[model samples]
Target: MPSPRRTARQADLLERLVALLVAEGFASFTLDDLAERLRCSKTTLYQLAGTKQDLVREAVKHYFRGAADAVEKEIAETVDPASRVQVYLTTVAEQLSSLSRAFLDDMAQFPPAREVYEANTRLAADRVRNLIAEGVAAGAFREVHAAFVGEVAAATMRQIQLGEVGARIGLTDSEAYEQLASLIVHAVSS
Candidate 1:
């Protein structure tokens, strides 16, 4: 079932919650801390979500949904399939580059939030696969296994999100994604 609609105030509060969690991370914050930081009562927050974990999950979902929408909006404007692939990944990189380490670590540790991220990663991989397929169909890219390439891209994204890319190569998540976009485009181009 669809969720009930939020009132303007509730919507505003949820937006604030998403921003706060993204900027500061949610793992250390208590409900009381959130209420105080948001300048609203705990009661107000309960209207947004039942518990702290639920609130964090909701906020994470809100963030990713918005990011996906923005990426799609950018993709809609680009005409070339190869350019679309680059735009899609780079746009995602731009969206994610703002995340703080604390927020990312918290996401990794929190099962619900982690699941949201994983699901989004899979969605992203599917998107990449489709984009690759389109490129091949348009004769913009050489024939390749789009599904396999998408999974490879997803695996690289997983590593980037886990901070492994940063640890091993000293590349920030955004930089790694940019590299991935370029590499994919180059490898696929005829």
Candidate 2:
């Protein structure tokens, strides 16, 4: 195992890398550029995170983990399943809205980043599936396939992220979330 100091330093490096990615589109920067931005040497970066792809994967995972934690907190605080689902979707939508446009633009420019992106997407989907399964077990939702509902919810969120449908409807992130929550509740509730 790594020493605590090493672990903390790695964490800090990861945060800096993520901040750089969020600020400057990923396509605009090379590893050397990232090292310059972070005021560190490329060797240090390689030591901290194996490769650029690994760094991106860690950054994406960290981002999604934070988002999932926020949504889980909202779900835990709500009483009813419907309200919980609403809070969850709303939280996700709000997060997506808060994301830097440069970040999205970067994802569009660098297709390799999609691998990391998709991993985060799968993590989010798994969380939704677990939430749905819990609601079903608690006799809150209908007798449908939790996995299917979770996949659909995840796909819908991705659509929103891609700016395919939700934004066109004048749905602020919050409004889009409310709409999604309503749809999910209607689908799952008997």
Q: Which candidate's lDDT is highest? A: 1
Model 1 deviation from the true structure expressed as Cα RMSD, one decimal place: 1.1
Model 1 weakest 10-residue run by lDDT: 1-10
Which parts of model 2 have CA positions greater than 4 angstroms off? 1-6, 109-112, 136-148, 161-163, 166-178, 186-190
Please provide, for model 2 over 43-97, each residue's C-alpha lDDT reduced to its tens digit, 9 standing for 90 to 100: 8888766888666656665665677787778777888765566577767776666
- Which residue pairs show collisions in model 1? none
State the lDDT at 86 in candidate 2.
59
Q: For each predicted model, how many residue pairs clash, with residues at least 3 apart or on different chains?
A: 0, 0
Residue 169 in candidate 2 has what lDDT? Answer: 74
| CA lDDT of every candidate | 0.91, 0.70
| TM-scores for candidates 1 onward, in order | 0.96, 0.73
User: For residues 28-146, could you state the per-residue lDDT of candidate 1 as single tens digits?
Assistant: 99999999999999999999889999999999998998999999999999999879999999999999988877898899899999999988888988999999999999999999988
**How does candidate 2 score on lDDT?**
0.70
